[model samples]
Target chain A: MPSIKQIARNEAASSRFVSGHSLCRGCGIPVVVRTVLNSIEAPVVVINATGCLEVATTRYPHTTWQVPWLHIAFENAAAAASGVETAYKALVKRGRLPDEPIVFVVFGGDGGTYDIGLQALSGALERGHRFLYVCYDNEAYMNTGIQRSSATPFAANTTTSPAGKQSFGKLQKRKDLTAIVVAHHIPYAAQASISHWQDLSDKVVAATRLASPSFINVLSTCPLGWGLEPNQTVRFARLATETRYWPLYEVIEGHYRITEQPLDPSLPIRAWLEDQVRFKHLFQHEDAEVLARIQREVDRDWNNLKRRSEADAQWFARHSERLAKEWTGSAARPAPAMTSRTNTNP
Target chain B: MPLKAPKIAPSARMRLLTGAEAAAHAMRQINPDVVSVYPITPQTPIIQTFAKFVADGETDTEIINVESEHSAMSAAVGAAQAGARTMTATASQGLALMIEIVYIAASMRLPIVMAVGNRALSGPINIHCDHADSMLARDSGMVQILTENAQEAYDLMVMAPRLAEHPEVMLPVLVSQDGFTITHSAEPVSLLPDEEVRRFVGDYRIPYPLLAGEVVTQGPFAMPDYYFEIKAQQVRAMRAAAQVFDELSEAYQACSGRRYQAVEGYRLDDADRALILMGSSAGTAKEVVDELRAKGEKVGLAQVRLFRPFPAAALREMLTGVGAVAVLDRALSFGGTAPLFAEVAAGLFGQTVSLSSQVYGLGGRELFPEQIAAVFHDLESTEGLEQPRFIGLRG
Candidate 1:
């Protein structure tokens, strides 16, 4: 077997994308996309939702992607990808696409995945398309000038949900998308952050190997949208996971497993809050109680995950053989390839 | 000696089918790769029949059940842009909801064909024949075709994809049939043979900008510098559609033994006054025209078929010797004049024809043949009328 370093070097040299495109400097989304595409060896079709990913890469006549990329509307990337995957399966069944196995993937921002595109995503998952969905969670609607989205953090000031004399930024809690995907009882669902590149790459590769729908919610940092220095994208993302403001974990076959644990039990939330203008209002107001309340919520959520991970690990070990048998039986059959000849004229 | 009337071919069978079923049958014949649809009243049967066809294994098309009309059009646009022929159906409030992306579909030139079961606009709640929904989308860069009955509804739909996908006319087509009048009514309509339609329409050829290995841009934001040029190109494309329409109609006539035109005339050859109308009301006017002609009254009717391209030159030539014209529209333009009436007056701008515009039959109220004939009476009584008039309204 080839060493990991050799594989990484080979992928870097043979990348389909070239340097110097219009994407913002240190934008975390392109990094995540490049890493995921580099890991897949099969022929892949990417369906992109209407958001930052689409606007930056496809500026009208110019496109940055060398692969077969489709830019559908804002809310139906999942549905469109479902159609593509269905067509591919029908074609393959008729002995088309015989050259190799093909993979289907969808990419979207939080506004697209957690809010507008949620219905299509839920339907696609329920229909069980053998594909992976990656949500590049940049917190707010970054491409539209940093507006508040359902994924915006609590007490963070955004354009739509500004903190003023009577307001403390966004009062609503961020939606738990990972848990929502797990409720569908899919085969694999994971949450990762840009801070851990190696772990993010490994999870992407593993998710694609599954026979059912798999979801990965990636915490991509937006230097411009988050109001930080352009080069501090990775640093901000690391602080997010380190402070337990965000968590990294996976749910496999109705079981939850925490991939990382916070090292400090009583870390001050102010450290994570002080980096950008979105949280500057809290510091200006000197509202310690509000800050303390948010910290408690984060801590409580993290502890619950730790407990569930332990229970899930125990259950999986106890019934490993039986679960394996059930999985083998329930996994979807390999879809046949689609070809022009199979599309008969009605 | 009169020219021999075209013989009706015996092999061409006619079946009584609703407008919705006719549209569904036409779509089945087109054999689109994907169809994304949502269920709304008046437009639901189109999808229900399509769903049945897919389930019965009668057609091999992928049907996506979307949550809303907005997503349905979005999905169809995406599929069409991805090199697949795609279609959807909606009406009334559903069409109103999809107003935003409908414009986008046309600007992108995706060659999408939609059937709008024309219904009354809201406020007091009505769901019958009216042109409110489709008239609202007049300037959205779509080729708008209005049908008179179930037969025209079916025939227009089969011709829609061909008109929309023409290389010079790469624009979306909106085939509008009166909501309950035609959509729910069953009538005998001759179905076109599938091979004849395929041969007439041919395959969709997207311009070089969108094809594989071609570096071209589509639907980009036209800044002040480029916006004018892009819009100018769209205007030119709309004008080019007239030629495509004529060519296809000629070809369809040769193959199927029936002919259609942008404007249909009824007994207008020797008439001093003509009532202009659109949609199913033309059927009622046709009856009135025949009755009045038998009574030796110098009255006739002219039905406007294509609304978007307006067919200005055709209407001008058709109305050359006419003394006075009365325009009847089923939709209200609020403070302004009626939509079809306004288009007619504008089409005959430089011509020397006296015109009277009237707004009536709004909210799907009953439009009697006598009510339409009253417009002719109003034109005759008031010589050189100064402004447009409204019929069937309380004092």
Candidate 2:
């Protein structure tokens, strides 16, 4: 129920992820985490994957997390969150727990979500756990020295996929994880960028308020790993979204909705690629083919999303009976606790 | 539906059930808040039957059918930390997948109880009876107890939560039975009233829970400064498990007229030779001991019930009057002696008795009474025990 401005102002007074941890000076992960956490209207239990957020926030006795938090291993954040949600249901149904609902949320990195943890995440969603999973896609294994994950871009340089004389960095294009998540047929799944705080915040609130598994993928910036000046983190994120490289969008039920359109006379894809050191080699080598390929992939993805979002307003209305009949298990469970209406944003 | 008569007289009642069924029955009695499990060979019956219990309104336990054992244990850790009385079951590769989080559950001091059906590890992938699975987690800091029969499986499982939830010992407990050998076979087990069972395991009170409005950080990134201290907390809890188990078992015995000890001694008094083993194989060893005693061979047997927190002093005391001892293990250590053999050697490092080791029952190979008697005879015949022997193995 909180507006974006009100949530930000309230968080400014008392931060859930406190300062003084050793994350990079302008890292976008904290911004994404804080923004997502502020949108929830209930007491939250945060489960974090093993990444910059987990390692830097909690170092032995000192922890920056003011909320109740847990970090167990790298890939089981979703699996662990399923436990919390299931436990909550079992206790509440048995009258051992209070009636108040506590939101279950997970913070996983791109490496954890797109690679090692895909099975667990898929399983939790398929089982219809009532929780929210946010993948802070910094695009590589930044915590373990920037290895190339499936989330890493095709031509981006990483420790594992370094650009050399004979070869370009990361030959394969990044996986369309949002599409893969939508294939699970959960109620809500979205693609947002940390630079678009309002879009990401709205997606988090919508995802957590539902009683089915929900996922949001945010393009979080990593200064140390992405080779950017500490101050240029937000600029890089903004450029990525403006160039249509990372679109601000959401998928509620089966329909896609774009939250922000690119600005008039938007910046070129080169502007998005030129600032970060991960892509500096592309400029130095003047690899026209790689740049064109990257642009082509982005445009194809954006056009696909635009077509889906521009569908008639009655898309769900036409398919509502089938969606209900298709899933009779937890997918179709009655959610009395989620009092708010479903996100039918056009 | 018309029923003619009650199966049992009012004075006493018993029913035939497999090891898995006994475990499921115990779960119903305990009525855990959450149960997360995956289906694997020799362990499928347990979760399947428990799911039926939930469907039939026998218990209000929430049964989560997870994708794999890794998630099964992972979910249990999260639920236990969230202050729910959680339980789970797995075996072999399933158990192997769960070892990482098993250690985490113990470290966090979450008193979750797991029932493991002992099956062999892979390579050839045989799904039968063996102790290889349970031995994989011997040092994971969880309290592991071996059961000798379906009756023992039920009794031990019912008592596990008490030991696990004790204030002094808040580590996880694993109640293991040999796969197929105990899990598939049926035996008569006495039933306890659900009301009595409920009173036995009262409310669970966690010191700090995730959703309890109190700010608590779990599974913290421990640096060098406090890693050892946090680990020592688990160690202290593990060490306190033996006493806690003993007290609870005595209390349970007062309610039901069955007694269980950390290490059960069978005919060990004034014996010249003996055999020591764990799990269902001990039943064969005890039978072999009785047959040897009938022949006046002066033989005895020792069954290890509590393997972790080892009960080293009690185990050593059980073998006091015996001469040569044969330590039996169903799993191999490859480069070293088997786990039980190693623990036994460490327990009696300076003792004067001649010690022998045997590795048997790998991949569910049949163990017989004769093989156990042979071990006792071999211990008596040999001048001094040296090389490790393989029981019932082809030459």
Q: What's chain A's TM-score in each predicted model? A: 0.89, 0.89
Mark the 10 consecutive residues where model 1 chain A has the least summed lDDT: A337-346
Per-residue lDDT tens digits for candidate 1, residues B77-189, read 66676556678898888888777677878777778899888888787677776888998789888899998888788788888898999888888899988887788888777
Residue pairs clashing, model 2: none
lDDT of each: 0.76, 0.85
DockQ for each of the predicted structures, in order?
0.22, 0.70
Model 2 C-alpha lDDT per residue in residues A1-346, reported as the tens digit of each score: 4566777776987678888888878888888888888877577889998888899989978989888998778878988988888888988898878877687889999999999899899999999998889999999999889999999999889999998897788989899999999999998898888787767776776676666899999999988878998888888888888899998877767787777787733466888998789999999969999899888888888888778877824675565566445433222123221222332221
Model 1 ranges off by over 4 Å: A1-17, A82-102, A127-131, A210-213, A263-268, A318-346, B1-12, B198-201, B204-222, B383-386
Q: Candidate 1 versus the native: TM-score? A: 0.89
| Cα lDDT tens digits for candidate 2, B251-282 | 99998777889898889899888888899988
What residue runs in model 2 are displaced by over 4 Å at the alpha carbon? A312-346, B1-11
> In model 2, how large is the Cα lDDT of residue B142?
93
Candidate 1 per-residue lDDT over residues A121-150, each given as its tens digit: 888788787778999999999999989999
